[model samples]
Target: MADPHERNGENERKPDSTDDANLSARLKSLDARISQASAQRAEAEPRPRSKTDSSAIGQAFRYSAEFVSGVIAGGIVGWLVDRLFGISPWGLIICLILGFCAGMLNLLRASGTIKPARYDDKK
Candidate 1:
């Protein structure tokens, strides 16, 4: 059986500092090449996003949820008011219109179409 610890006569030479220095130079050269290729790739123009890349479907769901939540909240309030005041259809109708407006406003706010209010100091 061959001994694992046995070194061949040619391989028994002492480790040389020149070999270590050469190895370090080679490693630095490889690192520089890798960094150059990486920078070039980063500078390259990106391809247009497909559906999976952009995920517009998730955004659509979020917008729809925001709008629907607003409407549902308004509707609930309107229903409560109708039950409280004995106003049958008029209250419900007015509340529904208000809810739709609220939902549209919510959607606009969410989409950045509506500007947010900024408070300034009165000094």
Candidate 2:
């Protein structure tokens, strides 16, 4: 008598439900692990969500530094001028005011409130 699963000399392979179920379970487990890793990585490395936020913070620091440096440099130069030329308070006052204006202009440029002359001229 011939076996029901045999066709000529070759044996036919019958599909197993358990094999399909195991493969599906393994695939689902891999997907879960990948999702968990991605979540962990995201949590571990927090980043600025927007370019504007990062640049704004940088600009704030830069403007503050520029303003302070201008004031200090002006004070030093004014003091030097007064000592060398014997003009006293007037030299310090005028130079300090000029420095303040220069600082304000720098801040405006940094904030994009004013257009750059050189850049505008180039266009």
Candidate 3:
């Protein structure tokens, strides 16, 4: 005679093909939604700008500040060094020259007179 538990187990078993098809359809739907979300995110993100993006007026103001600060700092240092070392006129004269050079250097750097180094593809 057939056992009652064996008969119940056969009745409870579900078809494997239906489960596989359902899972495949759910996965495909999820993949499509992910692709759409990614595209939207890309469109919402901001693009990077170049370093030399300032207007002419802004550039001029920056250069002016750089030049003035460099000259004042250099001159003060030179004067202090001269006074501290007891070099009177000689210290003052040397410091003035150094200050002028520093001012010019600052102006050149601000105006991009010196070219930036180029990166090589090697390495």
Best by TM-score: 2
Arranged by lDDT with the best first, the candidates are 2, 1, 3
Flag clash pairs in model 1: none
List the pairs of residues colliding in candidate 2: none
Query: Distance (Å) between predicted and true CA of 35, model 1?
Result: 23
Winning candidate number (lDDT) = 2
lDDT of each: 0.80, 0.84, 0.78
**Which digits, one per residue and each the tens of the lDDT, describe model 2 over residues 1-123?**
998889997988877999899999999999999999999999999785554647767868888987878887788889999999999998899889888888888778766679864675545
Q: Provide the TM-score for each candidate, comma-separated.
A: 0.51, 0.52, 0.47
Off by over 4 Å in 2: 1-56
Q: Candidate 1: deviation at residue 62, Å?
A: 1.0
Clashing pairs in 3: none
Q: Model 1: per-residue lDDT, tens digit, 72-100?
A: 88788888889999897777778878888
CA lDDT for candidate 2: 0.84
Name the regions of candidate 3 deviating beyond 4 angstroms. Answer: 1-53, 116-123
Better of 1 and 2 by lDDT: 2
> Which of candidates 1 and 3 reaches a greater lDDT?
1
**Ranking of candidates on TM-score, top first:** 2, 1, 3
